[model samples]
Target chain A: MALPITSKKAIREWKLYIFVLPSLLMVGTFAYFPAASAAYYSFFEWAGGDAKQLIGIENFRRAFSDQVLLDSFATVSVLIVFNLFKMIPSILLAVLIHRLRSDRWQYVYRVLLVVPMIVPGLVTLFIWKFFLDPNLGVLNGVLEFTGAKSVLVSLDHFFGWGVFFANVPIGWLSQPQLILPSLFLWGFPWIGAVGVLIFLAGLQSIGQDVYEAAELDGVGPFKKFLYIELPLILTQVRLSLVLLVIGTVGGYGLQLQLLNEYGGPDGRGMVPGLWMYNRAFYAGEFGYACAIGMILFVFILALTFVNNRYVRIDK
Target chain B: MSACPVSAASPAPRSNARRDWAKHAIILFFILIELFPLYMMFQVSFKDTTTFIRQPWLPTNPLNWHWENWTFALRLILPYIANTVLVAVTGTVCSLVFAIFGAYFFARYRMPFSRILWAAFLVLMLMPSVVNITPLFILLKSLKLVNTLWALIFVGIAAGQVFTIFVLRNFLEDLPRDLFEAAEMDGASHLQQVVNIVIPMSGSIIGTLGILAFLNMWNDFLLPLIVLRDKELFTLGVGLIYLDGEYVKQWGQIMAAYFVASIPLIVLFLFTMRLFVRGLSVGAIKG
Candidate 1:
């Protein structure tokens, strides 16, 4: 029912154009301009300052042969896989909350689920960094107190893993071998509060009649989940998957903060985004950084496309 | 409240109650595990370094609470917190204002090329900002805005536009058109119509969007890190990172700083918990 502004009566009301002008101007100047500039500068030999030259495909060519960049992508791929597994806890918690018989309890549980999120994500990252400190961390303290350290030592002896030794604190973030494990250990329980609520929102739309019908068919709890709950929430699951992929690929905050810009030890913690950051800021290779960014964009775009095309189920 | 019909209709109320307890127990177990880290943070915030080292697991004794840690952290991070509030509030308000106007334009009229304009915004949503950071820094520097809080505010407003407009346009479209029509009949200008009709009608949604945008700006680190070069301009995220990088690690003071950085958000979330959750779910469903 939108009235076309080209209509005779609406044409005179040209002032209506004023509504969108601010948005267009702001986005054009900040968002679009920078993006267009990135594409342009990717082909240059600029060092992020005044000096520049037309490098023509040279930056992209170097990116193609860049082992460090490729290895960073590999590290991200492993993290993405771990994140995919981490989604299970959130889904299970959502299903549990959705199945609660009392609405009051459901609200209480939901509020409690959101409580931990009040702390900004940056704060949580730092707290985890504190916990992962080898000598003075709660993680090592708990391991030693619970005798898990001794078990890990024996296993290290059996497996000849030099990372874990007796009477020595395991350098979780510092050691090359344990970098990925430390990253995975972050945000333990990983019951992403927002993720659970999204899945719960999806679950709430399921009618009571559906549950009754399933019960009549003698569908047990596990079978009910397989047949009904999971299917109903597949849309939300797909959405989370797409976002997780995008975030994991582009996110470098954790690595930049927890590990050094050099990516610690054998560069095991290096992610593509961090590599781009290091290139531009540390190495003064703005052109190469832009190329890396383009590579990340294409990679994320393709992953999102595949997710939408394959994992989709209309609810 | 969809207790299985079989269980509800049957005569086994006691076991049903027992099963409810089991469910609650399972939920509480997960909740406790999730809350452990936060609990540890709060407990350790009140302990000095020596106390933390000696009794890492136990709670700080009431007689020996290190109030100095809190005071020291506040003295150090208070300026950062103030800067964040100024930037987040101004940025969120400006972004929401612009978004409301733009969403109204998109929702109310279909002009020539309006669809194309809307499509441009949609494309912006999919375009990653990673590539743009270096150029954005250059852009801001060219405008002589870098290293100032204005840079963060402007970029925050710009980065927030697409999502806000997208969500608001949907909400505005679903609004009862008759209200706007009546406002037009009353000889209200479009701006007046927005102030009288749209703002009142969509207060909750606007509030939700505002909180979400504010949260994003508050926790933002990357843009501020790249743009700002001065310690005086550091937001909480960057400020905390610098604090952490100091050679002599004071765990107590550092944890206290984390708590200080989070207090404002915690206070805000306490009051707007429902709206915040609703906003997130709306975003999830619509994004």
Candidate 2:
């Protein structure tokens, strides 16, 4: 039933191959070409114009010693840690929704969870920015209203933190020392709708018999979650973990929008992608930016490889 | 089997009710926390600056609600919304069309270099878009497509092809091969087979992928921000950013604009809620 390489049937089947051409062309021209050009242009001194001079490995050399770039990596590492902590709420929410006894209520909650996603992520970021506003933000209003401000003020006094004081509005996004914490505070109760749905899918696959077995063993809810549910959803967890790393590492839109081009006060919020954006756009160091991009590509590739290699789930 | 002490001869209905109440309270608490910002946004959208600052966390009186904020924001963002919808719809349709054909090829026939072609698409998924932004910008400029909606559509198509094709190919692969073979025996061309059989069989999937591609384009500001220099050509995402910068941070008007920007996707989701959920679950299973 197979056609040999030189057979007439294969020649006759050539027309079928036309189906793939358009996609290949689109991908080759738009996606692959730019990536290939990034590699090629990484060695040049181009300012995004006609004038470009070849300077092999110099761009990479500068990136190695760039203090801001190194610091940006450190900044992202902190955000990554915060993001890891953030994943827990989604898992918890999914488990909660999955365990609901009423099918009607379970369906209702799942739909409710997805409602937030209809709001564009950009709009959400801006809303959070408004929330972090020092003078008129809801966060500060609630803090002052609930007497949390007084507690924070007392704590600041005890610790000599100097950042919190009574009667003075706290600059959550403005003060350099507060930027990273402000980022963590963004997307509060971070039950990502999609993440929850994903984990729910995994959890729903557990047979009812498993739960009955657990019930027979007198296992409490906590132990049931630990022994049965957690293990079953570990596959989804690992997938999310890989995705989370790649997204956090490569993402700069949040920092770019919140902190501006230079990454806010003292560049406290700078990440590698934002730095690359700044270099290419503001500084006109397009070549060096490409080099930075290449470094990021390699780093992400290796990180993904290691993640898949080490984070094993016994299926 | 040994019954648990709790579930032995008679289960405690009262305790189960209490536990159910606790679960509902916990879930509701988290949901309230999650939805609080959006709730604040909606409430603030109806207030003037003075009212918003004074009553920062509460809804304004109905008589004092600033409907003009909505009117003004609607006027300002209407053009950007139109541009975004045009780009998203056109790009989604084109990319889906391309992906359908490409996916059909991979799913149906095993031709020479099929593995290489499939690998090419798969590899793009691993490559981060961040690394390609600068060079992609340059490539667009040289092609003289910078500042044009076509640039966004083209790039969206390219970026969308990999995922759409990957997912659709899997769907197509699972379709009964006999249906295709029967059609082929009737002297139907490949294009005809796709139109007659593939499209009809995979309508729901096509709809799902289209929504996803449309959403990706609608939310994407970075590419549009980089490519489009003209204010008139700005999509909603970039337009909102510019509006935020240009305005004096008027809370009511800005929040109203944000609300207006969110309406299209919300309406889309409302109508296609089931399809959207199924799409995501499908992706979850596959991923």
Candidate 3:
């Protein structure tokens, strides 16, 4: 049947548009317009003020050749790998929590895990920094109690193969090579709280009847999870993956907090986001920062698109 | 391991004992790991710089317990806390009002451009905030809102409203049409129906979105960093960053500040965790 399009309908439509106008205007002015400008700014060379010059593709060319930019990209790649290592355990822990029958225990676990997330990032960083402090850290205290020769192990001996059989002193964050791993260790404990929340939500959305049906078919817990739960929760997984990728690529506030804005020792923890900030604000390389940001944005967009596609297929 | 078929009755006492131990151990392990740093922060916050440097792990022998640190940190942090609360609450209220109306329209009224608007929202969700940061900075400057808390609030409201609207619309759209029709037969105006029916029914979802928004704004660093230049107008996140930079190597003092800064958020999270979890599950399913 054809729908009627009378004057009343037109009037109602106008009212609806008017109602949504404020939100639309806000998004357009603050979000969409700036996004468009960010893309445009990438193509030109402009500082803070009206003083501008058009240097077409030169900014991009400089970005490509910049050693710091390349290092930042390498740093983000390593962060992504570490993030996956964190995410897997987080999901499993969330599943285990969901399976627990006791509501009191579940609630206790939830609150305990989430306590880390609620703690301000700087506080967590400070605590971990102290905990991992070479001379007086609790970690070293534990190490010494376990009969280690030196609390602060040298990086070479620590990373070397024979360290397992011998006491080898290592500087976790002070050493350039070990900085990424140290940062990961500091960051990983907080993931379980957020991941568990997201995964628990995903778990509840997977209807019980589907699980019951799988059970009736003599499917074990492992097989049921593989065949049913995994596919159903792909959307949540995709959402989290996209967030993680964007976060790792952006490497903005979190890394700055963890590394105290100088990046890790020897700039080993310089992610693209901080590099952009350093260039634009610290070094006043506005054009170069914009170019790097544009590239990073494109990378994140592509990753998000791929994630959406995978999510759709899984659904 | 032997595979034993379990009856509908209770399990063996030995197995129950083992299971109880496992559960307790698991819970204790995670709780200790998660809360250890927080506990350590508390302990260190009480000690002076000398004590902290001397023995970072253990409590100070003298047990200084510098209650003055809290006062100092509070004095420094109160204005920032006020600014943060103002930004978060105002932004959340603004977004909620806009989203409730927009979502209701999308759910009930068949408009010509509804689908297009929805599609636009979906795309906007994928656009990272960093993509807009530079442009937003310029825009806020042009509006003469830089160095102001309002700039942070407005930008946050704008950036955050889309997701809330999407979630709210999905939820309201799934409401049974019969209820709306029943309300219509009772001579209810659109406004009346929304006020009398939709708002009341959406309590849980709204609370969830509000908590989420509040948490996001409270923890946000970038927007406040770009917009608010005055130290007095800084949010906690940005304030902590500034504090870290300005204090030099006073790690103990900084950690003390960090601990005090986290208390409000931690309290808020604990109080609303159940609702927060429920909201996530509902919003996820609907989305």
Highest DockQ: give the candidate number: 1
> For model 2, what is the alpha-carbon lDDT of residue B71?
99
TM-score of chain A of 1: 0.96
Candidate 1, residues B1-287, lDDT tens digits: the string is 35444455668744665567877888889999888877877878899989998987778777889989999999999999999999999999999999999999899888766799999999988887776787888799899998999999988999899999998988898998888888889899999988988899989999989988898899899888888888888999789889988999878888888888889988998899898778777766665
TM-score of chain B of 2: 0.92
DockQ-best of 1 and 2: 1
Chain B, candidate 1: TM-score: 0.94
By DockQ thresholds, what CAPRI class is model 3? acceptable
Task: Please provide, for model 1 over A42-99, each residue's C-alpha lDDT reduced to its tens digit, 9 standing for 90 to 100.
Answer: 9999887788999899999999899999899899999999999999999998898888
Candidate 2 per-residue lDDT over residues B1-287, each given as its tens digit: 11122322345634443456677888889888878877977889998888877777779788888999999999998999999999999999999999999998888766788878899889999999999999999999999999999999999999999999999998898898888889989999889999999999999999988888888899999989888889889999789889778657788888899899999988999899988887766665554
- Which model, 1 or 3, shows the larger TM-score? 1
Best by TM-score: 1
lDDT of 3 by residue, A39-151 (tens): 77778788767887888899999998988878888988988888877787666666656555454566777767766767865566656776666666676677678755442
Q: Candidate 2 lDDT, tens digit per residue, A85-144?
A: 999999998887777665566777888887887888899888888888899877898899
The weakest ten consecutive residues by lDDT in model 2 chain B span B1-10
Q: For all the predictions, what are the DockQ values?
A: 0.63, 0.49, 0.38
